[model samples]
Structure formats: C-alpha cells, structure tokens
Target: MQKSIAVVFDSAGTLLHMYRVAKDMSSGDLLTGVESTDLVARRKGRALIVLHTEPSVILAVDRNMRVIDFIDGHDIAIDISCASVPFSVEEAYDIIKDSDIRVDDILQVVGVVRKHCPEIFYVAAGIIVDRNDHSVPYVLSTGGRLFHDSKETVDRLKGLGVSVFIASGDSRRNLKQLAECMGISMERVYDIATTREKARIILELKDTYDKVLMVGDGMNDILALRAADVGIVTLQQGDHRPEKLEMSADVVIRDIREVLGIVESL
Candidate 1:
C-alpha cells in the first residue's frame, strides 16, 4: 500500500528546543547558547561527530582508562553503524579514535565541560573536528526539551495518516527517548545522520509515499529540505536563519503545528 504522505523531521532545532554549549579547544573559551550548525558552518574542515553513549559513561572511561591514552593508541574508522544502537565504553573509544583527532586536544575540551557545566542533563555530546588537520576544534554538549507542541503535532499528523520519521545528526539513544515520547516507532528514527543521509532518506521515502515533506530549522537540513516534495523550514527555535537555509525550503513556518494545516492542504 502506498502511503499518502511521509514527513521527515530534524530533531534538535525542529522538534527539540535545544540549549547548546560548546568549548573551543584552541582558546579554552566556553560558548553558551550557540547553534551547532552555525558553529560548523563558520569553520572549514569541520564535521560534527555525535557520541552515542551517556556522559557518565564517558567520564568513567576517562577516569579509569584516560580517554586521551585510549584514543591515542586505537586506530579505527568512524563507524556510523554504532550510531543506531547503544554502545559500550570500548565502542565509544573506537568511535572517537575514528575521527583521527588529537586525543589530548579533545580531552582538554571534555575536561572544561566537566568542570563548568555540571548541572546540564547532556542529551548529546558532539565533537567538531577539522578533518584536514586531524584536530578537534570544538567539543559540544546539548540538552533540550521537546517543543511544547511537538508530541501533539506528531499525534495530529498520525491521525491524518501521515507517516512521521526523525532523521537527525543527534545520537540514537536520545532519539529513541524522543520517539517513545512522541509515540513514534523506533524503526522510523535515523540517528547520527549526515546531511547527505537525511536527503537520501527523503529520496528513498519518495518511492513508497505519494509525497514527502521535510521540516527542519538549520543549515544541515538544507539538502533534505530541497529533496522533499514539500520542504518546510520552521522558525520556532527562534534562532537566526541563514538566507541560504531559508531559501532552500519551499515554505517557511513559525510553529510546528502549522505542518498539520500544510499536510491537509496538500
């Protein structure tokens, strides 16, 4: 059976009201209330690597094994497969090693985060690495609550027979919790997804659904937004939208609930 419509959403800024904090490895400066995409966009050779384990686990590993030493010794490639499931400390070590980043640099950033941001819940921990120089320029930690209208919007979309999927660059562990909270199945979530992967998901969904709609709020969502049948960019996050990002979408909206009306009109 062909589904009438499928809506793909970006998790962080789209459905979650994110509070992001980043540590600049070079200057030892802490940047609060920043956008992750804007940080990545402003720098070159930067790729955001999301860790799929709890912050406590990483802290534990750092205490016993010394995160710097473990990563310095291990030579592994970044494995996206581990993103889909919860990973062990050993797996997390390997994932960090894959970045080919200088372990010492990242450790300092992690240390600063531990000292200053003790109260944050830490929904996601990410490293912004310079792929060319093999150094971590920034380490970021994010915590967010689901938008007030997020779950209701999801329920409303489902009532209208629209399939909802979350495709984001965030960790799967967090996305799983979000899926459960929104009553979306785990199978519909794509975690640690790259920009290309998000677009690919939209393109593939087009084969089974009559139309595909992508709703997102950042530069990272540009590719997927353009690929969908209807690309909707939501400004509910209240962040500054880049001209390029806004131009990529077919429609611009202020709230996620507006999607229900757009879907109905389609």
Candidate 2:
C-alpha cells in the first residue's frame, strides 16, 4: 500500500453547506440562508431563504417574505468579470473607483438589491478598511447534517498520522474558523487565491508528503484535485456540475467518509 502523508479538502460543499448571509431589514440582523427556487424569502426566526435565479441573480427573502428585491446578475457580474485584482478587495475597489462607470450606474445596481449581502458589503468595506487584513467576511453556514461525519473522518485521518490540510478558495480567516470547528489547527489551512495556486500548494507539499489525497466538489477545485496523488470528487450538497475538462478527479464518492476508505485501499 502506498503511504499517504496529507489529505486536502475543499471547504464549501465538501465540509460546509454552501449558503450566503444577508442583513434582514425587518429585524436589522444577519441571517444565514440557502438559495431556493421559489421567489419567496422564508425566514424561520433569524434564518433566511434566498431566492436564486440564473444568468446568476439572487434575491434575499427575509422571514418568508415575498420578493423583497432582485439583483440583476449582469450588474453584479460586470464588476466581478471586470475585476483585475481577483484576490485583493482593495485592488478591486480601486479598479472600480477609477473606472469610467458612472456613479449613477452603480447606484442603480445597489437600488435593486433589497437585502444587503454581508459578503459583498464586507469586501467593499475591506477595500476601505486595512488592505493588509484580508478581511473578506464570510457566512460560515451551519455545517451540513453529514459535517460531523466529515469531522470524524478528518480526526480518523489525523490519528493515522495523515496530515490534513484545507485548500479552499475561501479566505484565510474563514478557513481558520472552519478548521477550528473541525478541531484542526489553523496552520493546516491553506487559503487559496486561485485554482492553479491550489495545485501549486499540493505540488509543494508533495516534496515532503509524497502521497497526497485531495477531496473537492467544484470546478474551482479541479486543478488541485488533478495535482494531488489521488483526487476524489465528492457528490455532496452544493456541488456544481464539473465542466468538461475540469472533471479530472481519479475517484468519485457520495460521502466524505468514503475518502478514508479509498485512502486505506491505497
């Protein structure tokens, strides 16, 4: 059997449920919610139900409220697509501020957003706050029902002398929080800036670890998944359909716990 040293897992969709947080206007508080097909925002106490539409638009519905407001996906995408600084919120803001896009155009977009999404607000604030902090706020939605199982798997892997690390697109701070939740140390979390960077981390670790296993469930994870010795694609909640060439994983599983079994088989 091949000896394995480290196992890398993606944060969202692999260990945590994919959801966004937004400010509820009625209560003036933040709420975590999943995107839904219905055009209504169902709120159970402080929880929320986000209405999702494609071409990639999202509407935040509060407390079972109907159609609070809808944001145009095109408007949101314009800023994101035009952003040259993919990792730096400050750089992204500088580009936006210096751009020729009129202030009116920006306001028009904001006017349509009924719920103030914390992720967007924090990024905007991060640009104005200290750029060194890397303070992109995230809503660490409650872990999925199987999250405890995932944590157990991590514990088991660690007990077997496997080094477990998180290589995720999420910020360092967010990854640290997740690591703490799973009882992993912050040093093991790798805050990923790009898909290629994720792969690079795996390559660098390979220098010492030799046998590395990467478990992921999104298109963003394809590169790192391919770079690892054994890439396992998880079919968990919030998993996106892997693009044609991006599905480069060596194995596929329905549960995260299965990753341990595959590693044991190796």
Candidate 3:
C-alpha cells in the first residue's frame, strides 16, 4: 500500500535539545556555549566525522592525554561516519589517513570509556577537517535530551498514519536509543547522513509515500528540506536561523507540535 504521508526529522536541533561540548585540540579548552552546527559553520573545512559511541566512552579513553593525541594514536576507522558540505567518504578518510587509527581500536577504546563515564547519554569523537588543506583542528562531544514535544509529536503523527523517520549526522548508537524512546523503528533512522544523503532519503521516500515532509533546523537540512514535497523548518531549538536555511523551507514554524496541524491540513 502507498503510505499517505511520511515525515523525515533531523535529530540534533530539530527533535533533541542538544547540549554540546567541544575540546579544542590545540588549546585544550572545553567550549560549552556553542552549537555543533555553529562550530562546523565557522570552520573553513565544513566537514565533521561523527564517532558512533557514548560520550562517556570517548571521555574515558586516555583522559590524561589530549583528545586529538588519543585519536591520532589509535585506530578510529570503524563505526565512524561523516557529514560534510560537499565531501565523500573517501575524501573524509583521506583527510585523516595519517592518524593511524582503525575501527578495532575504537571499539576497545569505547568499552574502556563506557566503563568510566556511564552517566553520559551520547558521545562522539570526530575531527573538523579543512578540505582545502586537509588539516584537522578540533574534536568534540555532544549529549542531549529529547524536546518536550518530541514524543508527543511522534505519537500524534503515527496516530494519524504518518510514518516518522529520523535522518541526522549523529552516531548510530545514539540514534538507536532515540528511536526506542520515540517509538520509531531502527530501520527508519538514518544516522551520519551527509547533506546530500539527507536529500536522497527524501527522494527515495517519495516512491512509497504520497507526500513527504522534511523538518529540520540547521544548515545540514537544506537539501532534504528542498527535496521534500513539503519542506518545514522548525525554530524550537532557539538558535539563530540562517537566512538561507529559513528560505529553503516551504513553511517555517516555531514549535514541533505545529506539525500536527500541518498534517491535518494536508
């Protein structure tokens, strides 16, 4: 049967109220008052590799050394995904080729990190790469709670027979937990989606669903938002919405709950 409608959601700023912390590789400074998107936007590289592990796990790995040093010393080639403005997996890997990291080492490091920092909900380790020069300047960790309306919105959409999906540049481990919390199946969640991949998801869903709506709050979502049958941008994250991001959406809403009304109108 052809589904009546499908809604694709962006996780971090759209559905989750994220609290992000970044460690400056060069200065050893921890930045608290910043958004991950903001950090990515300010950097010349505009690319991020998201590590799929709990934040505490990453924090527990060699706390004595700097995050960059630990990443440079180990093998992080496994369970890592990239989000870039216009870069591919091969290009992302090429940038970090000299790090001497591989996936097996990352798995072992995550186990050690998890044993120590069990309180953290999410953790990811990835370098911000400048594609032009192939220089990595930073590593970061992020954790956050779901928005108050996230579950309610998901439940309401499902009740109305609209399929819900999550496509974001986050760790698969974190996205799995989020899927469980929101009653969304794992198959519907697309983790570590780059800008182009998000758009592709929307295009693919159009084949099965009569209508598709993409809801997001950041620059990464621009392509998906543009591709959807009805593109919606939410401002509930309370961050500064870039003009280009807002302009891409068919409708701009303040709260996620407004989606219910939009569905009704459709």
Q: Per-prediction RMSD in angstroms?
A: 5.5, 12.5, 4.9
Q: Which digits, one per residue and each the tens of the lDDT, describe model 3 over residues 1-266?
A: 53499999999878887655555545655565356666677755557776534444554566455434544566444333434456665666666664433333334334443444456455455556557667555555555678889999999999999999999888787889889999999999998887788999999999998999999988889999999999999999786888998999999999999999998888
Writing each residue's lDDT as its tens digit, candidate 1 over 208-255 gives 999999999988788899999999999998978999999999999999
Over the stretch 102-166, how does candidate 2's per-residue lDDT look in tens digits? 32322222333323332321111011111233221111122222355778898898888788888
* Higher-ranked by lDDT: 1 or 2: 1
Ranking by TM-score: 3, 1, 2
Model 3: which ten-residue window has the lowest total lDDT?
100-109
TM-scores, in order shown? 0.81, 0.58, 0.81
Better of 1 and 3 by lDDT: 1
Task: Give the count of colliding residue pairs in each prediction.
Answer: 0, 4, 10
Consecutive 10-residue window with the lowest summed lDDT within model 2: 121-130
| Model 1 residue 118 distance off true place after TM-score fit, in angstroms | 11
Task: Please report, in order, the local distance difference test score of every candidate based on alpha carbons.
Answer: 0.74, 0.51, 0.73
